[model samples]
Target: MIEAQGLTKRYGRKAAVSGLDFRVEPGRVTGFLGPNGAGKSTTMRMILGLDLPTSGTVTVNGRRYQGTVWPLHQIGALLDARAVHPGRSAYNHLHSLAAANGIPRSRVEAVLDQVGLTPVARKRAGGFSLGMAQRLGIAGALLGDPGILLFDEPVNGLDPDGILWIRTLMRSLAAEGRTVLVSSHLMSEMALTADHLLVIGQGRLLADTPLNELIARDAANRVEVRAVDHHRLADDLRTLGGDITLKPDGTLLVTGLDSASVGELAAARGHVLHQLRDVTSSLEDAYFRLTENSVVYRTPVPA
Candidate 1:
């Protein structure tokens, strides 16, 4: 497990991360989410001991990252795929990392095959495409067979096939009881992959909860209704204690009351109902609602 207590980082006058406290448990995939400049990368760096925190502490398993003698066997990470030596072959790169940690040479071939890079294992990493490079990085991370893994934008430059491959890999890793924490901008993919979510804004912890529960909170008490005259129904719904939003496509989104109550009220008013049903909120909808005040940048729509 990865644990952080009062984790904070400051750069000159800016606070990159402030008092972050969370735990990433084993046997599940946890997604780290934040807008640009929300200190996600800084937090990851602190967790990996790549950057020193101004205060607080972070630990993997039971020890600090820098205190471990064999970090490769403890936790695997892919913070930057481009950090690998460009002149070396994919096989050589993993071999070199394994050698540095006293890992046997045979482990290199196993990880290379695991990542499906064995076919091009001799190719120089400089010439590998972004997708291939991501695979190579993942191979290196798996070289040590660590129980914990961290990936930052692992699908940044991948095609659909590569993205699916990554999703499958993460799920498989979690199924094997490894702790997995990943950060990405793709909400749809995160919705499909992550069982838990850690959300941050302006370097502060905004939310830490299960993905389904977060989305369910907002979806509650919502009912979708369609009427012959949506505008008239909107007025009637308000009088019936229902908060209403008239969608552009002529659907009335109602809240503050259950579907049965809404239907009964509409029927009592002698109004013709075309449709009335509960509305389920998607992850994107819930994320926007939760982080509405946390966005640091906004672009005006083109006229």
Candidate 2:
């Protein structure tokens, strides 16, 4: 498990992260999300003890990461895939890492196989592609078989199959009771892979809640209605409440009323209803709504 208490990081005049507080529990995947320049990487670095926070603290399993004995066996992190030595063979790279931590060399091969990098174990890391390097980094993370894992943008540069493989692997690790914290810009994938979310905007905690709860909370109360007389139905729905917009194809987009109410209004207005359904926000929609104002950088609207 991982916990951060008032974790704040400052770079001279800028605060990369401020007062970030959250917990990552075991047996579930906790996703960290934010827009570009939101201090996600800075926070991860603080957690790994790679960078000291200007203020506040972060701990893994109730102790600072640097304070733990055999820290590799307690927490495994794949923050950057390009951290490995380019000239070293994949096996040798992991072997050196394991030796540094007094871990068995056998773990090197085991993790290579676990991450599906057995054939490339003898290959030079410099020759490997980004996806392959990511797998090697993942293998190094698993070499210790730590109960706590942190993967930042694990699926970056991965193909569709590779993405699915990573998802299944992360889920399986959590299923085995490991505490997993992964960060990504891909909300759709996070929706499928993570059980809980820890959203941040401008280095501040936005929301830490169950996936379903976020969707339900951020989704607009709206209905999708279809009827035989589109114009008449749109007019009637507008009279009841809320603004309406007609899609390019046909259906009317309605807000401010539930699906049932939309149906009742349509029936009362003598409109022959063809289809009516509630339109709830997806995780992507909810994430955008939550972080809309917190994004650090934005393009200026052209005049």
Candidate 3:
């Protein structure tokens, strides 16, 4: 497990991260989400010991990452997919990492095959496409077969199939009781892959909650209803303190009331209900609502 208490980072009086307190537990995939410049990458860098925190502490399995004797065996990470030497072959790149960490040569071949890079294992990494480089980076991360893994934008530049493969791999790693933390801007994929979330805004912890809880808490409660007497039903609902919006398609988008309450009211009023269902919000909707104020770069919407 990874834990941070009052973790902070600053640069020339500019705070990158502040008082970040959260835990990434084993047996689950935790998504790290934030708007642009929200310090997600900084926090991940601190966890991997790449950058020193100005205050507080972050530890892996109760020990700082820098203190681990065999760091690769304790935790593996893919911060940049293209960090490998341009002159080295994919196999050679992973081979060097295994050598440094005292991992067996056979493990290099195993991970290469695991990441589906066996066919191009001997090809120069510099010549590989972004997708291929991503695969190689993943192979290196799994070289030590560590119990903890951190991936940053693992699906960037990947094809649909590659994206699905990595999604499945992350889930499988978590299922094996490994501590997995992933950072990505893909909300749809995160909704499908992550069991929990760590959301940050302005370098501060905005939320550390289960995936479902975040969606339910930040998303507006809405319901959809259709009935034979739509106008009358809408009027009645408004009288009962419901905020209603009549759609061009004749359905009523409702808030301030739930489906059950709407149904009971319709029944009591003798309105023949055709449809009544809760309108559940997507992860993207909830994410926007939660991070609206945290967005640092805002694009002007067309008026």
Candidate 4:
């Protein structure tokens, strides 16, 4: 439903986004991830026609956003929750946005209820909290009932319950065959919500694959073995064609072989094994490890 080819964005001499190439297919939720200042937000803004790319082109549903006759109905985006006028009531805010695109007033109310902002529909947005403003922004995006949805950190300031709600909502939207692209810096949250991920670093594409595949590709398939004869077991496993690293907590970290093979070797050596299990790497750990060297800024540690 969305395609970008050689998309590049530059400001003065610095390229905020450089030659990004990807496609967001319909019927699946594509999670966009990157470190701070990695051009994720800039890229999203370009897709929404908020920023013009320096080179290449991006299209939603096979047409540029600006070229679409009814652009709001083709793609809905929530780039910033604070885009609404704080002085206007929630209902009036949506009504004004809806009228801009010639959308009916009923859509405003429908979307308000859809995003669970009906209770405060008449309240001034200036008095609403960040989470409430996020909901209002979401309501505005859904006002047109657009087929393609782009959410940039929809859960940024939300509570745990709001986070869960957005996750479920994204999945359901994709299940209904609508194109959904949600971006976040939280790898843990993305792991739970996204079926596929488009990871970027240094304004470049790093990896784009299924969530499970991304994890499995970088997963440290090591096993933690604790046995009565820890030293002896480590030595024996080293001879049996596996690398062993000793931990300070009286355990051996075994790699290059599965736990079952490690177990058999321990049994052959007459060693009593107390614990034998695979230690798979978490998505968050893998993400940090991959992006550590690409981070734009780092805080200094004082001695």
> In lDDT terms, which candidate is top?
3
Clash number for each model = 0, 0, 0, 0
Q: Which residue pairs in model 3 clash with each other?
A: none
Worst 10 residues of 4 by lDDT: 213-222
What C-alpha lDDT values do all the predictions have? 0.91, 0.89, 0.93, 0.88
Local accuracy of candidate 3 as per-residue lDDT tens digits, 118-165: 999999999999999999999988989999999999999899999999
Alpha carbon deviation, residue 1, candidate 2 (Å): 1.1
Task: List TM-scores for all candidates, in order.
Answer: 0.93, 0.88, 0.88, 0.87
Q: Which pairs clash in the backbone of model 1? A: none
- The 10-residue segment with the lowest total lDDT in model 3: 214-223
Q: lDDT order of candidates, best first?
A: 3, 1, 2, 4
Candidate 1 residue-wise lDDT, 1-303, digit = tens: 999999999999989999999999999999999888899999999988999999999998867898678888988899888888899999889988998887899999998888789999999999988888889989878888999999999998899988998999999999999999999989999999999999999899989999999999879889999888788878988987889888888998898988988888888888788898998899888888788888887678899
Residues 160-239 of candidate 4 have per-residue lDDT tens digits of 98999899989999999999999998888998988888888888888878888878766555789999989888888988
Superposed on all Cα atoms, the candidates' RMSDs to the truth, in angstroms, are: 1.9, 2.7, 2.7, 2.8
Error of 4 at 273 (Å): 5.2
* Alpha-carbon RMSD, candidate 1: 1.9
Q: Which candidate would rank higher by TM-score, 1 or 4?
A: 1
Indicate the TM-score of model 3. 0.88
